[model samples]
Target: MKTRITLLALLTAWHAQGQTLTENSMADSKDIERIVVTGSRIVESIDEVPATITIINRQQIEKQLKVSPELQTILATLVPGLAPSTGTSSNSSQTLRGRSPLVMIDGVPQSTPLRNGALGIRTIDPNSIERIEVIKGATSIYGNGAAGGIINYITKKAHADSKFNGQVSLSSRFSTAKFEDSTGQRIEGMINGQLNNFSYVASASFEENGLQKDAEGDVIGLKYGLSDAVMHNYFTKFGYQFNDDISMQLVINHYQSEQDSNLVDVVGSVNSGEKTYAIKAPAGTDAPGEPQGPNNQNVMLKYTDQALFDNTQLVLDAYAQKVKNTFFYSPVLANPEQGYDGGQSVIKSDKKGLRATFNSLFEWDDLEATIIYGIDALNDVTSQPMVDGRVWVPEMDMENVAGFLQSKWLIQEDLIVKAGVRRENIDLAVQDYKTLRLCKSVDICSIPMAVKGDTLNYSATTYNVGVRYNIAEYFQPFANYSQGSDISDIGRLLRTATVSDIADIQTQASIIDNYEIGFTSVVDNLRMEFSAYRSTSELGTTNKYDPATGVYMPVRAPQEIYGYEALAHYQLADNFDITATYAWVEGKDTKNDIYLGAKQISAPKGSININWSPNELSSMSLTYLYVGNRKRFDTVAGEHVGDKGPINSYHLVNFSGQYQLNRDWQAFIGIENLFNQDYYPAKSQAYTYSGYNVKGLGTTVNLGVQYQF
Candidate 1:
């Protein structure tokens, strides 16, 4: 604690001395080139975007790196409507505006779900990131699964300078808050070079993380039960400039992690009757509980090109990715009968797939346009080896192929129209195998369930038409309509199929539509954006397990949700800045008696965030999040129990600063949760799992140093 205070004191003195130094030059308007993304398939400034967006640059990340213990936590607190909570390896999903948002590296899509490793999104090392761009509204250019918006992590590329540059950094964190202590170490290195018409860049990072505890000193396992793990990432890119109007580039990236096993604790009945919470052995478990390990790997490749013809320019790009997931757990059925001779064994699942996409951009006339169309095709192949547990047949393959097109038209300097459409087809096939009890000289029982090679075709035409009119030099009004869809996991309930039934197999996917409108304005250093929206989800097949048959059945109803968000930011001056935002959501079951529906899984409203940075002497951020009360059924028969009532709303306060000891080096310090407020995240599992929901981490402190040459 004293070390932090001393660092702050020194920072104050250093800033005082620097006050006499000339301030960093502000970027010229022309020099600040417009930033564009696949979001629209066309280039445009942040202000020209009709959808809500929050741009977090390298500078912001660097500032946070000096204070925050983890980059993931920093994102949740900084971005409005982006609430990233702690995950149990398998729960590392990110929700944008109350819906699961898609994450991409450059333009490579990531395939992560329940069957994959539990590493949270935070697993990506922030040290290698060049910038993080977040689009807060729905997007059509990115295709399926982008209903909640998208987050693009753009990594560092080879610099255009004709000189070689290299950098190496090492850092560590010893303690967070007074209670939740943690230790971490990281090594990062990068090299950039440019010569003639060619340029190349390569970077790698390796980090080891120690277990983290909460304010109450309870060990919260974000990476499973094992507290320590290691992750490595590598990136390389080569670009060639053929002529003044032509260029080509190729890029490769990879990430891997080694982690300890994670286990979920299920205790005995806490309440009475059928509504009680009991640690019942999963359909085939031997004992009361079991352990599971999570592991994953990702690799991506891309090719890009640029050309100029006449008065118009063209750009083309392509990307591909391969992902593999392995999960290890103890099966329940193998040990169901206690006192049985056979002991417990582990069950394994392997899921792997690939994705590819291509896009293009063009400009000419008084109208600048961006047209993007691509396809996403991937396969999920999994295996389950019986180990005394509920032994089920292995080898399942599921594939989905989608083709889409989106275009943007700039009719005038301030008027633009965008539209998109996509058609998708999914094929699922599985083989059934029966176990013969050789000792009995016959087959005891056979589970004749499998996907009999059937294909489900789905098509959705989603379009957004909006106008952004500059009402004045400082204000703009905008509005648009957007739609999204969800590819239901129908194979989970298709257990009655056989090779002969291939022709009779049937499946359906869910589609979600959203209508939105709002206005934004920027004057001097103040900026404000607000939008209202309504969204709906047509449930295709919601699966639930049947204890009697040891099978899963699909529900016959759909769901809907509606919400709105308002955000504001102000740079009071070169010496100070402040930001604030709010969101409200109303989720409901449009077809069933169930009050919570699937929507209950997300938060129900009320969140505020504010940040203050004065002259760099010190900066602080504070946030308050509120989740409304809700209920969910315990079983197909039992009434909903212990509805996670309006979980307590809590506050988080953080402060950070840096002190320059010399012109080239500086020391940094910061404190999180200054008030030590206690609360639970919107992702807390108390709503269904065990009655005891997990609590958010409390206050923490960080100290570090950096030397720039």
Candidate 2:
């Protein structure tokens, strides 16, 4: 840390900076090859985009995988505005710029818009991904769930070098603080190759973890924990080129992760300043209903024609997905009169969709324009039910049709303009049902109500416009205004209904407006991008705490959220580089004049990475992350409640090294929490709910080796 600090200070004092420093759509010639297809839904250069986007290449993906297998940690370390990892299997409360971003895989939406479980982020394994593209800010290009933006995972394809090629890898992991029973193993293998007009790629991976302990050698809480977990993933892809003008591709992936621990929660109340931990269950204790986090599957097929017509391209996509996310057993689901102690529930969703697009290009003497038009149709069936044949949330069927048009113009190859419009028509149907009776205390229970269900209709037209100007070599600025149309957590609203008729319930749509302005700069050795944004919505979807029943009810109000993000990278030498990112966000209830809690927002975050490549055969990187404090609401009776607890800051340092032993062999190792800082994660510190105050992982190590055929 000191060496890099000294280098940066000396370089600044001597004014030795040179080259390029940029963070934004238009970076430099080095990144021109980075074609972004998310924000625009078509093949286009980054410079043509009038928004902030982050692209994570394959090399960067593999490097971060060595440090931590979890994609959550990797994304938080790299993406500035994304919330920190929750250190659990669940990604709840980890918002992107104070809102949930739509997660997708190769343009297939992975998020369940009606009932978001926040498990979409982990639906696919890292080995199956070639890259990740993030489009920041509100957008309706993809429709429905993209309230905050989009995160699209681009999958891998077959390599063209050989007819048949394969690789195998194995890894070992254990807690550095206490390795007695805290050990794990992972095995992965993949084969990919090209054969004339046909190409294919397939991979399989499995990992099992033992006990996970903290710095003080205590097992973390079993609720949403990773201890004693087993995960499996299978992925396959096939491609055929009928001709140069036409081609087809198919992709399928299945991922499953579940924990079957022999330990149980040693339950402690966060409100009373006690910490929650886990210990071995009693000898005669029985297991829960089922192991949590069952499985997710995705299948996609695509047909594309490069020369469908003169100066026009055509693409068609068909996709289907299934997800079963089983949650932990909770007393909040208990009903005394029903002779139930606690129950477990699972959120299951089956989704199918089709999309068609056409891109037409036109060029003139001093201007070039591209027009993209598309149509999308989707059907989603989702429900949440208790494992013991009890209905918590009835099944909901939703169908949607959307039409969109996007236009891009480049004037003199320096000034770019973009505009788009999307029209969404949706219908949701549900049968007559009764809300389940839930109890927080024996005497305090929620009354069940039988509600009449009917088909609900919603329609919206959203628009976006942006412009960018490359005025000079050192300054590139962009500004944008956009809107997102969404039906936020409709399933929750229906499940907790108090009225006898669904129509009487507040089923208002959430229309969010977002405005952003940012600039990128490149000067010698420094490249930087900074932006500021503000978002507002008349009908908010913030959750209101119901102390009587321990339920979070939907509350409507006006909300305003604003934030800033900055990304910078400096090259100290030809072989050494230092990159840094910082993000700060704040939100408020515009109607109530009170700041939002951790449930809706997170504290500021900053990260730094120092990379060194000593030679062609060896490389190493050290990463540092800092989460600042956020104190909003005060405690009641000297005890914090809900997510209103104050958050204390924490620091993390990680180390990763890779070396090529031979032409076909390579070794890698990573050390997480290198300093053994015994601290609670940001979510754990601010979430005062039971079983949520688990400590962050201690010093952990991952060592692995790979071999190629």
Candidate 3:
């Protein structure tokens, strides 16, 4: 209660004094000029969009890269409703708005819906990103797999002002608790130039990571952890301006990260209150083969024409992506005749797609109107197989064709109404495959039968409508209704199938409906936004443990989720600024009369950021993040046996600063967990009994230097 009151008072004070600030202040002018692309198919200013959207500009991205190059950490701090990072290479437990969101790079879909490898979010390196755009709530504007929202990672573009420009950066990271073998280094270089009507940009980076430790100077668990890895990234973009009204561009990116470790995990007993897990050197002399990370390659070709006709615009894009991810070796009882003790698994996905859009604008009397229409076509093939040539998940092929239309109407100078609809057709083909049946202690076991080859088809029509009223320069009220559709955990379903054909399996798509009401206020040097939303799905999907099979299976049930968010940014003085964000979310399974599991729902969270720039040569920032207490299930017989147990509140503080030494050189440093607080992550607490639980990172420091010419 006290924290809430303090935050409210701060906001109120800013609102009362904002009018006294200079009307032509540079900070105020910069706030309202930012443009975003994810809100709609076309680029529009932030104030023109009637939805909840957040933009992480280039300056913010650079600041975060100095600390950590991981996208998970950067987004967790910038976005309001996103879950915290798990200190691992996998993002299985992290969700957006209580659901999985579709991730994209330059408007090209990167998520493999057929067989989600959970590697989409880490496909591209942070150095290549120009900015990040997050569109909140359920939206289907860009096709399927957007039940929650969309995160678009826009890549860097060429610099047209210079004939040749280059930047070189080097960074070093080490653990502050114990610095022995916990040191990592990275080097990156980028060059951009423009000549005549053509422009090009190219970049390359290489990094090597070291061991990770906890607060107690103990080695953290290495099972699916982010330690001792090697990463490489290559990117290039080329563009040509055919004329004043026509343009063409091509983009290519290649990213690879692998984990190589000489140690194995030492399992700990959670029932006995033993939380520390250690790692020991392996016995065998076998080499730690290829690293356990994703190898991603992407290419895109885009063409745009502003004068297709008189008052019309056209955009066409074609893209292809290939991703392969490998997992660490796990204990799997295999037949001696196969000549293997244990095996590893790999998931490979290939996608190709084309998209085209047309926009037209016109005016009639006192009203201005605009129309947008587009078509998308895509084909995807994905498979999961063991290293020894055994199929864990058979190859699945999917094809999708979709079309959409949207219209916007402006009434005088106060109101704007927008409406849109989309239709999607999807076809999936699967082949017959056998399931793995491993026995314990050489005992005979009954193997589940394989599912036969079959074809499945599905179709859905999603719609959205919204209205925004510009009451005054300081306030704007809006209401929106949106819808989304997705196939929940298709990979899990296919890998654990016991049916003979596709018809016997439950492959129905889940449709989500979302309703939202919100308002935005821009008063001088202060900006604020608040929104409330409710989303429901008739056939929502949740995971349940199958004790008999020792696996998790997806179950369909009626589910509803509601949430609210508030954000404020105030310029306290000419050299100081503060920003605050808060989010509250709750979800329940209506059919079962129980709350959703932690994997599907996250607790309330808030963050505060302060920036101080006393002069132009140096700047500093401090950030505080808080996760509230959450308890969802009742104790039965003195045992906590439920999908979600109990979670305690935790907070963290971080500080970073940058200094410019001369015209050609600069230096920066970041200190994470400044106070060195020892606490378990919310996800780990929710899954305490699970073997996958692990502790969060302790105090760490990252310092870097850069040279530009």
Question: Which of the numbered candidates is closest to the native, going by highest TM-score?
Answer: 2
How much is the lDDT of residue 596 in candidate 1?
Answer: 41
Task: Write the residue-wise lDDT of candidate 3 on 1-709 in tens digits.
Answer: 2332233223222111211112332234254236566667775556667788889887878877776778987888778988776667777657788877889998898877677766778888888887899988888898877878899998876665677998999989888877878899999999987787777889999988877777766666765667788899999988877876677888899999988877666655333445645565656654343568888899999888766887777888899999899877765435444555566788888999999988777777667677889999999888888877878888888899999998877677468888999998999888877766643224543266677878789899999999999889798999999999787467767777777786788878889998899999999999999999999998887777555654556778988988999999999899999999998888999999889877778878899989898798998888888889889877655655434667788898888899999988999998877877777777766764444556677788888999999
Q: Which ten residues in a row have the lowest lDDT in candidate 3?
A: 13-22
Summarize candidate 1's per-residue lDDT along 530-589 as a digit string, tens digits.
Answer: 887766667633334344444334554565656777777787666556677676555556
Write the residue-wise lDDT of candidate 2 on 1-709 in tens digits.
Answer: 2332233223221111111111222324344335576888775667657888888888788888888878788888889899999888877777888888999998899888788878878888898887789998878899888888899987875765578999998998899888889899988889987777777889998989878888887988877889999999999988877875677888899999999877888777666666788888889986666888758999998887766787777888899999999988887788978888889999999999999988887878778788999999999999998998888888999999999999988788789999999999999998999999998887878879999989999999999999999887589999999999978678888888889999998887889999999998889999899999999988877667777766778878889999999999899998899999999999999999988888779899999999999999999999999999998887777888777788889999999999999999999998889998998888888888778899888898999998998
- Better model by lDDT, 1 or 2? 2
What overall lDDT, based on C-alpha atoms, would model 2 receive against the true structure? 0.84
Q: What would the TM-scores of all predictions be?
A: 0.77, 0.95, 0.92
TM-score of 2: 0.95
- lDDT to native, each model: 0.51, 0.84, 0.78
lDDT of 3 at 9: 28
- Where does model 3 exceed 4 Å of error? 1-33, 269-271, 276-278, 283-290, 332-342, 438-446, 634-643, 688-690
